[model samples]
Structure formats: C-alpha cells, structure tokens
Target: MSAPENREAFVRPPALELRGVTKRFGAGASAGRGARALDGVDLVLGEREFLVVLGPTGAGKTTLLRTIAGLETPDAGSVALHGRDARALAPADRDVALVFQNFSLYPSATVRENLAFPLAAPARRLSRAEIDERVAWAAKLLHVERLLDRPAKKLSGGEMQRVAIGRAIVRRPKLFLMDEPLTNLDAKLREELRVELRELARELETPVVWVTHDQAEALTMADRVALLVDGRIVQTGTPEDVYARPNSPLAARELGTPPMNLFDVERKDERWITADGVELARADAGAPERATIGVRPEHVLLDGGPSDAVVHVVEDWGPSRVLFAHVGAHALHVLAPRDCALRAGDRFRPTFDVRRVVVWPRA
Candidate 1:
C-alpha cells in the first residue's frame, strides 16, 4: 500500500457509515412491484454509541441493519467501516456480529458449543484454551454459565436469546447489529434482557445498531434514535429531544405509547382556539395561520382543571393508569397515577402544560 493509503487507513473513521444508500426489490416497473426498502439513507455511527433504528412495519429498519452487516448490497451508495470501504467485504470479513430476533442458534448444539463456534472457526484459528476462555467469559457475562451444557433446543425463548447473544459477543466484534433480539421473549423477560444488554454494551464499549418497533424499548435503550418512515430517516435525536420536541407531528405520534394527541388550532382574533372552542396559548409571531398541536399522554393533565373532555375508559397498568377520554369529537389518551379517582363514563377536564406542547405548521 502507498504511504497516503496507509495513513488514510490508520485514521479512525466512524464505526459505521452509509452514504446515499438506496435499495429496492423485485421488478423495477411491474404492476405489483416490491417496495423500496431503503431510500438514500445517510447515517454515521460513532464508536461505543448505541443507535436504535425505530419505525413501523415496512419502514426499512431491518434493511438498514442487513446493509451494514453485508447481508444485503445497496443498489446505490457506499458503506464504510473503520475508515475502510466495506462494499466488497463479506459478512464475516466486516468484523460485525448480528443477533437476530429468532435467536438463530445451532439447535442441536449445547449452549457452550454455540458460544465457541465463532472463536473456533478455521479462519480465526483460536487455540482451544483461548476459545474456552472466550466462551466461559461470555457465558458468565450473560448469566448463562449454569446453562452452558444445556442443549439450545431445550432452552426457553429468553434463554436461547441469551445464548445467541453470547455467541455474538464471544468473538468481540467491532460492531453489534441486533434486530429485535428481545421481541421473542415475554414482557418480564424482555425487560430483564433489555437492562442487561444496555449494561453489556457499555461494558464492552462496542458500537451497536439496534432495530425495533417498540416505542418504550427504543426510548429506554437508545443513546440516540433514528426513526425511519417510508424508507427514509424522518428524525434522529435523543429520546427526550425526539419525544418532547419533534420536528413534525408524525414523529411525535410515532414515539409515544398511545401516540400524541393532535388537534388543529385555528388563529381567530390573534388567539389559538381548538375546534371545541377551548382557548389554547397565543400564537407565535412567525407561526402560520393554522397549526397542529401535539401533546403527549404524560403531559396531558386531567385533574380539577378546565373541562373540555370526559373520561371514556380508565386502563389500570398496575403502577400507572391510562385514561382514554373524549374531548368533543376527538379521543384523548392521558397517562396518570394509579391512585387517581377517575373511572369510565366520568366527566373531566383535560389541559396540558404549554411548555411541553409541540406545535407544527398545518399542511
């Protein structure tokens, strides 16, 4: 290699990079052609960062991860890893590990055997002692040391997922690509694994690109979130930033539990008013004539305040209660404390903290 080439190679690049990435499927102009999975995606992942890719079905979350892992080639654009072009690199050569939603383990093999496979590969040529050490460490880290000798086929969904994750971590890859690894487990197990995975990522200091459709998981686990919609990145920011202050009403609706409550406010007499004639805050100077206001369920207050709505249904979630209310013709979802004395068919007033409300120009 030339001196300049060597110098360029030595310069640390982003852990993962995609420039103008585009991927489509099936026929180009068929009547029922396959959809475009990714559209001109430009993303950079920094070292030791946890970036969660969030979106609905067909939003291209899995496609982005596959492109990074070299499982799918882009129709256009470039992929680079650690300052090197990765377009030609095979999946194994990319120094990236992928953990799938299905816990894709060797079913016939023992947990220990599954964990050792990556380290014992012919290309790696690791000594048995080294491979054993790696397997032991991974098993211990994942709290699966007791189950190391158990067959993968006999384990529960959560246990198999832990083993699958152990296999990926045993190799100590430069990047981790996780595609809904916790989706298969029950809610309690999913929460347990989620916390463990976050700690493990921090301990290893490895860059990770996690793909999921769960809003709570994305908000809790991501250092930063990249929300993909219609094969494009609609927004990328910290969880609080994205939830509290969204660039668009669509982004706000996508992140919340029951989604944000959106209402079109009209500018009448220089005052913002809802359709129900409820008075909202004053309009901003540069704000358009009409704007959509988004308020989250947590921010929506349903106490002894103004009365523009009635309690439709109260859902008890143990520690929290979700009130589905009717404000005029609009349905409002509000999150409240479990001890609140509200129930079905009860009348109540819904107001929100103006500071927490998000306003977007109506289109």
Candidate 2:
C-alpha cells in the first residue's frame, strides 16, 4: 500500500478508553490488605492506533489487559468503547478479540477449526461459507495457511502462535488485545512475527492494545508506548519520545538494550563528577544539584591519552564492542565501534555525548 493510503486506512475512532480504572483483589481485611492490581489507570487508544504496554513483572500489565478484555471487572472506574460503557459488557458482547500469551487454542482441534471457533459464536451468526472465508483470510494474513489441517497440539510454538492470532483476526472485532502473543516463540521467530503482526494490524485498520515486556518489540511495533510501573502508567508517548526523552529514571532504564547506565554525580563547584569519576561539564548537566545521572552506553566515547580511566573488560558484539572501564567505585560501559583498538586493561579516556545524558533528582 502507498504510504498515504496505508496511513488513511489505519485511521480509526477511539476504540478503547480506561478512565480512573482501578482493580483490587480480595477484601480490605485480607492478608495483603486489598492488593490493588491497577491504581487509577487512565488510557485512551485512538482508532487504528497500536498501543504497546510495557512493564516489568508484577507491574500489573496482565491484570490491566484482562480488565479490558472483560475477563476481570475493575473494582472501581470505567471502561468505554465507542463512548459506551464497556465494563458491564460480556467478553463476547464487547466485540473485542484477545490473543493470549498462552496460545489458548483447543488442543485437539485443527488450525482451521480453531480459526473458525470465533465465528461460530451464537451472537456472530455467520454463515458457514462466511466463516470459511474469514478463516482463510486470517490464515493468509498470518502466513499460516499451510498449517490449516494440523491439530493445534502438533503445531510448533511459532505455528500455534500464528493460529491463535488467526483465530482472533477471524472475529474482526472492534478492538484487538494481545498479551505477549510472540513470547512463546524463539527469538528469530518472534522477530519475524513482530513485523508480520504490525503489517496485519495496519492492514485491518483496527485499534490494538498489545502487552509485552520486550522493549525492542515495543520500539519496533508500537506507534505509541505506555510504560507501566507498579500498576500505574508512569509515562506514555511515541517510541521515539520515550526513548530519547524519558520522563523518569525508571522509564529511561527500561528502554535500552544494556539499559541506561545510572550513576551518582557529585557536584564539585563548577563541574560534576560521575560515580565513575568522569568529570562532566556543568552546562551540559541536568539536575546538577542532584546526585543521580544516566547516560546510554552508546553515548559514551572511548579515546586514548588523558582520560578518566582504563578499560578493564571488552565484550565484542559484532557491530560494536562494550568496554567496561573502571574509573572509581563503578564501571561505566562504553559502546565502541567494532574496529576500536581497545583491549582489557587498555588505558582509555571516556567522553560523553553531552546532549544525551539524563539527570534525575537524587532520592
């Protein structure tokens, strides 16, 4: 599809809304004292927008998704779809399709049968021919048409995942919710399917809310990302916004491959000393009065001559090398170009991209 046509096709109305949504488990008298899975979570998904929710484990990511799918009702707050109250709606009545992490397919059923199951719902009332057509279309979209006759139990993890996605797509629901749908597959297959799913979601022009802990997947597939922490969304923005300008230390740390290097900075008159003893310019430092500083590995540069310290370890990672150097009480990782002539115990000076450093208030 042409870029303009593709963008236009994906235009959609607000398909999902969560306002002051809070989900609590057990009574106030319980041992945990009413564990709140969600705490006043507020979110909105525009038509055809792909929103990926990311968080660490125990962050209530799953609970938030379950609530939206109508499998779990929020103890407080409301869910709306197309301006209608959705909290009172049943899972089927919500016209939402969920592709779960566990690949919740009937083990004994063939791929074709599993894909047809959603269409067979009494409320759908689809004709047999229509169901077949939908199943065929979804299978083609997911590139699983060849596995149609195989029983779900016999399919590989990747194939089963495709089947699960196909089943959800056959319903053509107003909203699509995926809970780490590619987590079960191998890394290579997961990467492959990530692109496929993005294309499929774009083609269908449906709003999607996907939950995943994989930062790379979030960066690659999501038009916008919601960073959830402790059952609350800490930040929400486009992948570029969140990655380049994270509002919190936690959000910045969560977006990188090796994660952002966090250090305590001590202000010494006009300059700041990172925990690793690298002197930082005051003009380039944010929160200069604070003690914490964060910089991504890629922003660090390795040079010879007058430097902070020497490289203690070098890990070659094909395109680049991660140089772990000792400056003081901490190790600062520097992402060096592959040809960088640095070895363990090599004397190296470190330079930082001043514009890329992030400073956080000391706690």
Candidate 3:
C-alpha cells in the first residue's frame, strides 16, 4: 500500500479570515445615534482565491475593504491575516495593498517614482538594483513600460490606472484589495484590463478581494462571489451557481438587469392559480404550499398556445429584442429574437421550460 496520507500536512490556513466583523460610525444624539457601516460580517479568503464582493450602492463594500486594510477599526470581531491577528497593525504593517477607484497617484511624481515609492521606504531598505528590478517588472506587467518617464498628471485615465496597479505590484503584498479600479475607464478599456487582472491573479498566486457593483465584472472575474446587502453577506458561491439558482427573492431582484420576474401563486388542488385566476400547470410534488415562481426575461418564450398578455413595447437591439408586456395587472419583460413579429398592442403568451423556473417559498 502507498504511504498513509497526512491530512494535517495538506491543510492550508485561509489567507484572510473575518469573524463577526462589525463597525459603526458616530454615537449618541449628536451623530444621529449611530450608523452601522458593517454588521456581523464574516468571511474567509482561501489561499490563492480571487473573491469578488458584489453589491449595490451604499452596501458597505468599501467599508469591508477598509476594515481589512487596517484603515478602519472594527467595533467588534477579529481579522486574521495569514493566521495572525491584524487589528492592531497599522496600514503599512498589515502587508496589504489597496487599489482605489480614483487612481491615487501623486500628481507631482513621475510614473517611475510612484511605482518605486513602496520599495523606497526605509523599512524595506532594498538595494538600488532590487528596487529597479521590481519597478521594471511591474511596468512590463501593466504595459506601462513606455510611460515610466512620463509625469503621472500628464497620463490619461487608463494610463494612470495602470500605474496605480503597478504601484501595488511592486509592494508584493499577501492580500490584494481592489475597490472598483476599473470604474473610471471607458467600456473598452475596462474589458481589456479585466482580462489582464484575471491573468495577473493566477500568476501571482496571491489572494484577492475585489469590490464592485457591476454584475458583468463580477461574473467574469470572480472565482467566487460574496453578495452583500445592507452591510451583510446574504450569499456566497461560484458565479454560475448563484446565477442559475438564487436562494431568496432579494437575490433574484439583484442579479439581473430587468431582474427575475416573480409571480405569487396559490395552490389549488393539483394546479397553481395566478392572482388573476389564470390556471397554470401544477408545480412538482414536495414544493412549498405557497411560493413565488421566478423566470428570467431571456427564458420567456412567445411561441405558445394562449395569449395571456399584450405587448406594451418592443426594444430593438439589432441582434435581439426585448418585449415589455402586461400580463393581468403585472408587467413582464421578455427577451425575443430579432425576427419576432409582435408589436405594440399585440396579444402574446409567455412560456418557458419547467426546469428553468426557480421557486421561492413564501411561507
């Protein structure tokens, strides 16, 4: 027989771990009692994991990163970085790098100086050759080798953003925290950098926690996504898993553009009855007695037997079309092909595969 495996030997500790992390701002009557920036937030970043924190505006995504970077102290909870308590450490002592949305480059410095600043500090005390080597490596990695001599203030938004990333790369931190780094760039530049960032994450072998409100960005770049709502983590899973199966109504509302249409239904004998008394096929046995039926816009099909609603509007996109329809009192959105002949005031029926439907229990 082969040698017995050592489970302990194979076990690797998390790169970053948070337990019951809570942070509040202000107190008493002067500051409106108090406001909680983060409440009982707990998360763990596995070794070499690229975790994206996704949420809407005012979801405390930035606060979470500030807490981990030691910029904001938690009112309660512990932050363990590489198995060491990091709460008492200063921002620099934490050995973490943060890339902000607005590229925080020094206006007076050249691209080379900004990239060299982290290594030039007295604590690091690196030799001239070592610092030069690191600076050159970062410049090449970010495709900013030609801009090294250019003043930071003179560079375009995209160029400055790359330099900001280069600054972090030279530090070589254990954890990388990016707060909407691509938000300021144009659409094309955002897409280009997104691919580069994903590749860099793999080559560096460092844990990264990226914060963004863009669904497309999260779906494309994340190995796993942590969905936050009102300062709390509502769900965490792979992009494919969360998109295909949302656990709650709140999740369905947040994931898509038009979002998942939820229809409240009542079970009547073996059939399900809509609010307007339209009877549909019965849900499978063992489903909740009272639940909401959810289906995506793209899944709604128009070629069916009955006309349940009238098309209110049609949005043409060359390749496909989006139909806005009124079904009883509820408004529904359907994604249709460019060949769709339905127009305004046209009656149509919406249908979809049973397996594609997501059921959310009401009771």
Q: How does each model score on lDDT?
A: 0.86, 0.84, 0.86
In candidate 3 the C-alpha lDDT for residue 180 amounts to 93
What would the per-residue lDDT of candidate 2 be over residues 1-363, giving only the tens digit for each residue? 599888865663367889988887878823535888899999999889999999888889889989998999887889999778997788879988998887579999999999999899888789999999999998988888999998899998888888888888888898999999988789999999999899999999989999999999899999999999888898999999898888888887777876777777777665667655567544343345656767788987775323466788899899998888876556777888999998887876666676787776675
Lowest-sum lDDT 10-residue window in model 1: 26-35
Model 1 lDDT vs. the true structure? Answer: 0.86
| TM-score per candidate | 0.90, 0.89, 0.93
How well does candidate 3 score on lDDT at residue 352?
54
- lDDT (10s digit) by residue, model 3, range 36-79: 77888999999899999999988899999999999998888999
* Pairs with steric clashes in candidate 2: 12-47
In model 3, which residue pairs have backbone atoms overlapping below 3 Å?
none
TM match of model 2 to true structure:
0.89
lDDT of 3: 0.86
Q: Which is superior by lDDT, 2 or 3? A: 3
